[model samples]
Target: MRYAVIILALLILVVGGFAPPVVADAGADTAAGLAAPAAQTAQLGQDDSAQTTIVVNVHSDTNATWKVRTRHSLRSSEDVRAFERLVDELQRGEANSSLDEGMFRNYAELAAESTGREMEIVDVSYNGTVTDDGTTGVLTMSFTWTNFAERTDDGGLRVGDAFTTPDGGTWFPWLAEGQQLVIETPESHEVQNSFSGIREGSVVATGPMDLREQPIYVVYEATPGPEPPDPLSLELVAGVGAMLLLVVAGVLYLRQQEETVPQSDTGPASGSVVDRSPDDLDGDDPDSGDSDGGDDVDLSLLSDEERVEYLLEQRGGRMRQADIVKQTGWSDAKVSQLLSAMADEERVNKLRIGRENLISLPNESHRTNGDE
Candidate 1:
């Protein structure tokens, strides 16, 4: 089974185009010009000293809004350290993820690349200042997207110029694959989102503007062409196909074995055999456990790194510490203390990078790097 997994992984290497454990890789130098947070960082400042802030209370009151994998929160205080592990891996000679996902970094790295452009994050408070009542908080990020084809500062490609987009990426085929759709929030905000194009293409799409995805290479995607298929989707199809083939082969082998064996005309031995059910497989949880089939228990008591790793792994790869704070409303001091403890245990490595409360998930690189 392990060998089969290894082979499948080799196939993924031949296929899955991206790096991981949590990071933005090399070739991802100057996003726009900001210094990539050399170290993964998380900082908390009591912005409004006069007001008493309550740690946000997160409850699994509603399961519909709580998806185990699709939705994620900064699950552990140690995430920043895990994030640092990825940075060290990148600094070392591990170029796997960089080579794979290098193309997309040019855009995502802007937050890390703003070298000299007066970077500022103006957050919206819930005190009803921006609106009538304090029901929402807004996060506003303004920065330069380095390769802005037409630099107003330096003369190059300007407005009214079109760039060619690519077709379905690494995985999906027929569907638009990984296409970008333009979105302008109700508040007159503008942003771009990626689309799968299968259950999520244009014709089926019935809301707002449809902009092209953030291209791996800006020079091309801005224009008109085809979008790339999702890499994960492709891998899924590949994995499924491979698994199905293996199952078929196993079935045939079993048939061959049966034919070779002398017919003993085996009958049911003795008494009735018990068949187990799904819930029976994993023993029933204690009656007092959580209601979501017992999967999500109160994990707050777990140590920082343990909590973070468990949550991120449960999700795919990434998570923001801020998001976790928002969901759980944990205090900065507590969060920091727990994460520090994890660093001491070498379960995670903490580094100062990016802005406040930023974190990343762990990957193989984290295991080898000493926590700081």
Candidate 2:
């Protein structure tokens, strides 16, 4: 069964014009498989219950780590052993010539020629495992492909160009049914745009998809740098300093007036005493009590969620969750719960990038890298 699957894949490659010369001497079953359509051959070679997941992590240097894992339900020990044997053969470089590193190198060379860049495939490895209850078998393979992304003029990355054929035409590698491809962005970068597939924090394409008809292109750029110091903060500090200086100067002037005043020990006459309101003494000026500035929001009047929204607005409608906690002096758990609730309410957007949650106001976009 393993040989048949390998032969089927090789036949598909031959039909697609991407086969290596080492696979030219296929058996009669290969010819028989070739008689069917390439998609049908791929579908027939795999079990209906099997699933394949391909994760491509593109690094900042344009190198990519590819991890391909296939899981199949095993009805008996023979099925597990067959999977183990296939993994062993693939690990020892004795699987089919089409499944070896040379074929990948050939693909990389063609990609390099098409993109006008140097490309190398390295660190190829394989692993196989079975569930402890022996109900399922898993086969895993991984490799690193260097220069798999093209750097843009503005210091961003343009992936998917490396998958083009040397003739500048669309070329899609074979993907079986129940297969999925996940393209992760480099660290400290956020996806800017995606030409194909669903982009929800990361790029994902689920098969059976015809890449030849709809190709994948993803663009990501580094997160924006820290914002400059808030000018409002500086203005507040200056206002406080001016108020303090005025208070000090008034105190000194009052002291000088007391020292310069002549002593008057005469007691007030019995009916000369007058009652006065504080406002009357201060001279009722309408603007005297209006100390609230346009930038100042009375946080004491706001709820916890509103306070968070206010903080996000202060920081250009986006902030890290940790920064929110720090700015609001709230506990981590409290901030997390508040943000989660706000996100559920669609009042705020929370994007988990790496270990932190980037909080943004509704309708406000945040720059972020890959998310898990």
Candidate 3:
């Protein structure tokens, strides 16, 4: 019996030795399975704090064009390499493997380079180091693409639909901090229906999309604004002022010359000379032109001042002195002198508002159809 037992024990030991050693390395296998994914997660966390900024410029000319500029801030050399690989994968239409293999294939080109019957990429620029030296680095890229569209029709632009990194996460992933999208349009075009409702001229701005697996879309509709008025130039104003001054000076000089000329003493030509003093002349005295022969004056014969007075009566009895100069095409000095004379003669009242003068005809002065 002892010998039979010995033989059975030997048989058991032999079977044990021949069987596979599954239990011996089970712990090692489990640890290896857990360590790989954890290491990958740790590597991704290093570069998850980077930022991205994008600028889009839309031109709605004869052909609509779109210009896109993207800037990425990277942290380490591993992050830089990861981004480079991501870009390559996107170029080959190998991105977003869970979707159709080539789903994001054309996306990078749209922001980098693309050519087709409906759209064309006119220019592209990519700058930065492939690897950062253990510190933060920057990567910048830009591309301009064009699409055929009617110039007169309203134009629209869209950006930001896909947001993902290639290395699954061990690479440079987009961060939301400082992420902004700026859209600029033509001068006469106004951007409407923007995400943020913040716009200046034709430029529109919005904050970055939240960090998520889903894509974000930004669309803008542009329409023309009212045609701008012709700009007033300093040179034109100066030229008009100089011309008015010459005209006023010439008229004054001619009047002065006429007054200085001597008159003939002999007036009777029929054979008898009627003796008369200078005061007896028909129109020599200034008092003869007055209506009441008192301080009441008549401005009917003064053509320049009369024209200004007529303008004031037409413009609700009041107008700015600068406006008067513009309306009469006269110099500022000439308008000021005429307004001062009218004010002194009590024909018009002048009120000063800040640095400007407003002139109005007197209440007693009524518009008469006879001379105006």
Candidate 4:
């Protein structure tokens, strides 16, 4: 339950985005009103352009580990055409965020400073769960950004649109009237982490998971950038044409390869495999259209007896569910059931390995006389 709470908080923080800001009416006047039209300011000195929006979504786990990200958007009604440098500036900033694998590293340092805590996460699971008990399942994450003033500041608080850290990357922007920009958390992830395990830190995630951009759009101000490229102009005709050509060529190549290459059907195939024959299969999804015959490794489809045999054979006498899922792309439900069955057979001992299950096999595969 503690783990669940941590995971939920993690979900909320990491699921970044912008919630719409309440635009202040232009008719509002100040205490010393003299040619001063008042709209809401992000801060005392900031202009109305500092207005921003924010959004977020969250989830949790049985194990006590989690993440939380923020997304934000900035809006202003300044004549967009006047700022021809806008596109270039945005691109440059995005490029900085990406170059040298800077995003995570930058955040890690910033977070460490913000919380006075070192940043560390273990075993970032490529796997996610939407449980049979729907209440506990994690899915459909999003974020909304409102005014920064929503959160009360007591002790020496900082405010405004440009949320910059000591690190050179300007983390957030100040916003303006009717101008809109979006930022969000990535929905999909498949990264190899140093903390997962030395023995198995190199498993490629199996499935067509989308690696998406996540943005947190709450509370920020915009810093001006270079001129935006003219959309109607023919300045980058050759560049755009080349990009399209590459995409077309890549698509054609993939189609040609897919036809010739007999690939294993991964994840939940759109249809089912009806092979009832006694041939042993490495991969056999009950709901898959195609089967590349047993070449695909699917531990979930194996019978309970087969699971025990495989665990004993590989781990000497015991095996963990993590081993199976890491080795084979079994879903979480299948992994849980498979592991429970192994425990019934007294094949492995389960232990806590950060946010995941760890299995330890017995030293001996075949027990001698009087062995339990």
lDDT of 3 by residue, 1-372 (tens): 322222222221122111111122423423222222222223323333444455556555423333222333445557556545545543454432111111112333332222222444445444444433434434444555454222323455443322222322211122244445555654445544444445564334333333233333344555556767546766788889999999999999887644332222111234644232332232334223334234323343436667666555544455667766655555687778878987898988887766877676776233321234
Candidate 2 pairs with clashing backbones: 189-369, 190-368
For all candidates in order, the CA lDDT equals 0.30, 0.65, 0.43, 0.32
The residue-by-residue lDDT of candidate 2 on 56-90, one tens digit each, is 89999999998766676777666666656666777
Model 3 segments more than 4 A misplaced = 1-46, 62-105, 108-117, 129-134, 148-178, 196-372
lDDT of residue 345 for candidate 4: 76
> Which is superior by lDDT, 1 or 2?
2
Q: Candidate 3: TM-score?
A: 0.32
Better of 1 and 4 by TM-score: 1
- Which residue pairs show collisions in model 3? none
Q: What is the TM-score of each predicted model, taking all chains together? A: 0.18, 0.51, 0.32, 0.17
Worst 10 residues of 3 by lDDT: 12-21
Tens-digit lDDT track for model 4 on 1-372? 322222222222222111111213424222222112222212112222222222221111101122221122223323122121222332343211111112234333444454344443333221113234322212112222112211113211112122224442234322223322322212221222211112231212111122122222222222235678787666588789989999999999997654333223323234633222222122443233243223445655655446445543543333345445543445567667766776677765555545765554543322322364
Question: In model 2, where do residues sit more than 4 Å from their true spots?
Answer: 1-46, 97-99, 173-176, 197-200, 227-372
- Among all candidates shown, the one with the greatest TM-score: 2
Order the numbered candidates by lDDT, best leading.
2, 3, 4, 1
Residue 46 in model 1: lDDT? 9
